[model samples]
Target: MQKNSSSIKSSTDILKQAIQFIGQHNITAIPINYTVSYEYCRGHHVLLRQAIDQAIVNKQPITNEAIQGWFDAFLLGYDLSELNKSHLDLNNIVDQLASTTTQAEEDVNQYDTSLKECKDELNETLDTSSLSSIVSSLLTSTTAMQIAMEQMKQQITASQCEIASLQDRLALVTIEAVTDPLTGLANRKGLSMAINESLSTALQSKNYPCLLLLDIDYFKKINDSFGHLVGDKAIKILADTLKKQLKGKDTAARYGGEEFAILLPETDLQNAWKVGENIRRVVESLRITRSNNHEEVFRMTISIGIARYQANQSINDLIELADNALYQSKNTGRNRVTIFETKL
Candidate 1:
């Protein structure tokens, strides 16, 4: 997931182009549509660009469904259909190898029988013609066995290489499925997987685990004032800051939109509060300058809510508690931390 960068003016220009494209096509200005159009304008995804270009050249109507299809096929890690096709191909290769191996085994058995016959013939009293025929038969059997073995070897080698390639692609697809393209953080699905694993381990080890939900204060205002590109930069900044502040064992994710979630293993409520407070202060101190006008600098703040896991608690319940505390923080002030207290 390499991020694409451009100057502020250039980004704004691209944004305008994207909007114009969407308008011309009579497509709705949804987030996905905007994203695909922006990427097309940037020419980042070659296949995506080509699809759009071809549609335009052929006078095909650009529809939302078409854009979404392209996004899923190209922008996303890999297409599900393509993945299934790869699996079918892998199965076919395996089947071919199996057949080849069976053929080779049969060839070896046949060659052995030929040798036995030749031995029996040699054991008997035979003339020059009889001996010559036996020798020729042996040569033919040996050659056929050699050719079968060679074919098997080549098939095995080819299959091995193909399987390795498929494995690599599957690994990449798995990563991309869980990763957020914009901030390079774990997406919600990844976060949930991490939570499940942590919860299972914590339940066994009796270790404390805490979840923190953070939301950028006035995030929509930032988007409205500067634009979505700048807003995206802000989110990336927060994500990077979280990565720096947290330990390797902790899991950080872009929960959704301007909100983020952090899972801390072996951490109690008190320690979680400290972590949340530290992040709040650090983000408050950050100065984000407008890319177009450096003189116009602004600061961003985040509100965090924390909830520690309890015995027999579900993941959804824990997240809800954290969300409640987050609502408390938002209601109290724009930037603060709140810890959820369970009523005994």
Candidate 2:
């Protein structure tokens, strides 16, 4: 469909036809700048005139269908400038005129010379009834109507662009409200919301959700051994890696300094265990590098503890249970996944 389209070429033709078509209607006293005859086409004028002339050059016998096809073709082309709707409207008129003229030509085929003569009269206002009635009537009756519709279309297009721009702005606004800038993860506020929503849904559906609280083990030593810059990079890398592992519905957050959390909705103890193991394996496999005079690599892992919501427990109680399990993971070996064991 896009094969024959060239934006400039199509628009130029549409404008050419409009000027010629309008002149034939005798609706206006304006001069065509009718010089080299062909040269009227070469100059820059109102876009509608150009569009009409372009159709004429194709030399297809003007018929109603043919005229419609021409206008439809011109419309298929991209709008060159916002101000060109007038030109577009002009193109439409030319297409209509051409169609009517083709009908006139066929009816008066016996006057072969008359069709040629009418075509010329179409070039400018001359004494031809078909060209005058069919071509010119289209011009006089609908001038106000076409102008109004074109203006409305342009307004609609402008409004759509504004809507899209505002939507993008809104998304950025939303991100700033709930995201941790440094780690590109959810902030405390965002994480709290996730916990509440997850718990609420679980109570309604009776499907327990698991929360995993995670913290980097011996994170302070890296700050001491490498420097704060490397420490920050380590945090960012881990955040990015963990985020990649999480599903769209799951939440990963920079809960606080050197700490992160994941909220897994609709998940139970068994599923949470698999997710924890995957996180553990992925964290163990990271190869972080620091820029020294040459290069130095830094590596570490996370201690994660998973806790499932009890049927009647509060969201805060659920968070604390996960936190305690995370502490146990850190205390036992520093790099492992542990599930909270509630007091019987």
Q: Which candidate's TM-score is highest? A: 1
Tens digit per residue, CA lDDT, model 2, 71-113: 3544334222322343343344444444445544454453455
Residue 31, candidate 1: alpha-carbon lDDT: 45
> Estimated TM-score per prediction?
0.72, 0.51
Q: Which candidate ranks first by lDDT, i.e. highest?
A: 1
Candidate 1: where is the Cα deviation over 4 Å? 1-99, 102-106, 109-113, 116-120, 123-126, 292-296
**Model 2 worst lDDT run, 10 consecutive residues:** 29-38
Note the Cα lDDT for every prediction shown. 0.82, 0.67
RMSD of 1: 12.1
- What is the C-alpha lDDT profile of model 1 across 37-130, one tens digit per residue? 8778878789889999999999988887888898888787532333343345455556666766887888888889999989999999578999
